[model samples]
Target: MPTPASPQRRIGVLLVNLGTPDSPQTPDVRRYLNEFLTDGRVIDMPAAVRYPLFQGLVVPLRAPKSAKIYQQLWTERGSPLLYHGLDLQKLVQEKLGKDYVVAFGMRYQNPSIEKALDELRAAAVDRIIVLPLFPQYAAASTGSVQEKVMDIVSKWWVVPSISFISTFTDDPGFIGTFVTLGKAEMAKREYDHVVFSYHGIPERHVLKGSHNNYCKLGTCCNSYNKNNRYCYRAQCYETSRQLAAGLGLAPEQYTTSFQSRLQSRLRDPWLQPYTDEVLKEMPAKGIKNVLTFSPAFVADCLETTIEVGLEFKEMFEEAGGEHWQLVPSLNSHPQWVEGVVNMIHRN
Candidate 1:
């Protein structure tokens, strides 16, 4: 028979997300990018090639340019992703009450996964539930967090029973919350089109991570199949479908696209129509007003704020489109808080 856990055993909840640098300076951005991009799971390159390429080339060339963008997005409260993560930890703690201890960590930067694990260990938690904040599973995002969690726990003398949520891309409550917010925004403005934009990853990286043969990189993701439905691209499209259904949106009025793809060329393709490309074509398509949602990101950050919000808006405007609105992220929405609490309790 399996042994029963001690009645006094405590449970810990660790919420993780891709991190942001502490400041908007070039040095800070360089360090943050170095740590983030250098991870084997993230860049998927050999250390010999990746290390020098990142340290010597990418960081030096990209940091100054990226830092300028971060500076525009930085606020008195610091990186939006980090602060929102902190706020979520506080709110989830309150909602879950004293039964479960909740903590937050960044996969790559400050308040890191190691530090979060230490906090839980110090509290002597008997069980831990790790919830990576990526709605969709990608090796470069959630997989990296899971790898770090295992790395930390493997070193512990008394490792706790662990439960990891790989992804919640189609969680009914999560989808409902997003739909509610998007609908609310649409009600306020008469947008001619609704665009669902999700963060992009290299196509090769995604195909490399898929466990099934279904992700053939083309029309395979248009319809969800039970086998590969859990694929990141499939789930992203499913997220859009559910949200669109909830909002009573017609097929012609809404479209799904990928955004923020890094440099890569592989025979297998990524989920597309790309966001920027779509925006540039909007005016010609007779879609003047647009509403965009970044469902892949639960918290507002550079990807959503600058990439989707400002950059896409500018592109649409430049292309002669009229209103371009971005739906706010699910920062601490009540239903989202409830979802976190439920996930903790259920595990």
Candidate 2:
């Protein structure tokens, strides 16, 4: 145990997300990106290689461009990602009530995990459920959260009983939240094809966790199984499959693609067909109007708002498509709040 305990007991929950910049300014963006990119679970390279490359090259080169995109995503309420997470925390806390205390932290920026954990500890919480707000269990997302929480809590002299909600990508309530949202959006706009766009991770990350080369990154990831249980790509496909099934979409009517890949050669073999590439090709394939879903993210942020919702929309327009609409993310919707409440109760 890392900290001495007074034996006062209570129950608590901590919600975590990928995080956002403290502001849309360049320096703040640099701080957030530097911390995010330097995580081993994210880069998966040795310090000798990762720190210099990230600090010297990646952060300096990308922070300005990223800061600009974040500026576009900023709201009167501040960062959408942070505000959404904060609201979700409040909603869940209210739902849980006197029985459980809830706090939220970001993996990289403000509302740090340490502070959230400290809140739980200060409340004398003896049992905690750590919910990483990612639907899928990618090492870079859920794994990174799990690792950071442990590294922080492991130092306490009286460590609490902690259970991490690694992934809820397949949970009915989770799938249902998106399904409900997706169906509503579809009713508003008709498109030539529906595309499920997930955040792209390097193929090597998936292969590393997949047991014994079980994932070939082909049709093998088309479904979920014990073999590809931790395979992020497979799980993304699974999310798409279940959502499509719920929306009464035929497999042929929709396609799944990866988006927001870092093109630096180090991130080679990112999950593909890339969303932008897919957009460019779809127009030529007798498809024009498009509807897109980004289930990998629960909140609408720079990636979902600008990258897919704006940038890809432009790409489709340039490719001679008439319309390209994005389904808004599951951010603090009544259904999503309910789904999260259910997850806590179940946990």
Candidate 3:
């Protein structure tokens, strides 16, 4: 049998998210985008090709408009994504008690990974559990986080034991909390259809994740199997399946789609049907009123609050759809809070 952990072993828990702009201004947004997009996992291009794209094109053109969106998403306390993460950190810390030191940080900008790591190191933690706030595994999200953390910690004078939670695709408590939240929303109104819209990665991201031709971009991903278990696309579909089964949804009652694709030089197709395109055509298929669930994001951020909640609402309204209901993300909800506590304990 394995040796039991020491009684004096102090633990540090770091909760992480994608990130937010330091401020909701053009320059701030530009700076944030410059750092975020330049990550190799995010852009996935060599420095020779990636440098010009963000500096000359992406950041310069998108910053101003993206700033306006952040302005709308900003709260009196600060960005919703940042504040919600703080709340979650506090809640989980309280539940875990005095032995554990819990801190929240963003992959980019303020409360950065460097700051969070420094906090843990100063505390003289015996071991660290780094949990990326994403439910599903994607290299651009979880992989980027793991790589960044290790790179920083490797230089520490005295490195301690480290653990990382890459994904929670099949955790019972994790899936159950979402089902509870979704059912509560569905009871308030009857919807014509429900859509599980996940953030889109470049199609090559999915193909690169597949093992031995596991992902055929066909019905193959519709079911979960060992070959495709690590695949991001497959895990997303599995989340949708579990929630749909819990809610007693019929096979035809819901569908999966992807959102936030970039216009890159490569013609590689992102996942389909695209959420924006699908929303426009949903009304024509006799499904006027709809509800959307963005499971990829735990906290309602730019993509969830503005992109799906507000922007897509406008699109559906313009298309003559009667209703566009967006299920709020699981941001420090009580059940979700407890569930996260359980997840930390599992490690």
RMSD of each: 2.9, 3.8, 3.0
**232-291 in candidate 2: lDDT tens per residue?**
988999999999899899999999999987765353788888888889988889898888
Comparing 1 with 2 on TM-score, the higher-scoring candidate is 2
Off by over 4 Å in 3: 1-7, 264-266
**Model 1 stretches with alpha carbons more than 4 Å out:** 1-7, 264-270
Give the alpha-carbon lDDT of every model.
0.87, 0.90, 0.90
Q: What is the lDDT of residue 181 in candidate 2?
A: 83
Global local distance difference test of model 2 = 0.90
- Comparing 1 with 3 on lDDT, the higher-scoring candidate is 3
- Over 1-347, each residue of candidate 1 has an lDDT whose tens digit, in order, gives 99987677678999998999989999999999999879998778899999999988988999999999999999999999999999999999998877778889999889899999899898888899999999888888888899899988999889989999988887876888888898789778788989999987777776775666667776777787676655888888888888999889988889889998766435545557789998999999889999999999999999999999999999999999998999999988988888878777777
**TM-score result, candidate 3:** 0.96
Give the range where candidate 1 is weakest over 10 consecutive residues by summed lDDT.
262-271
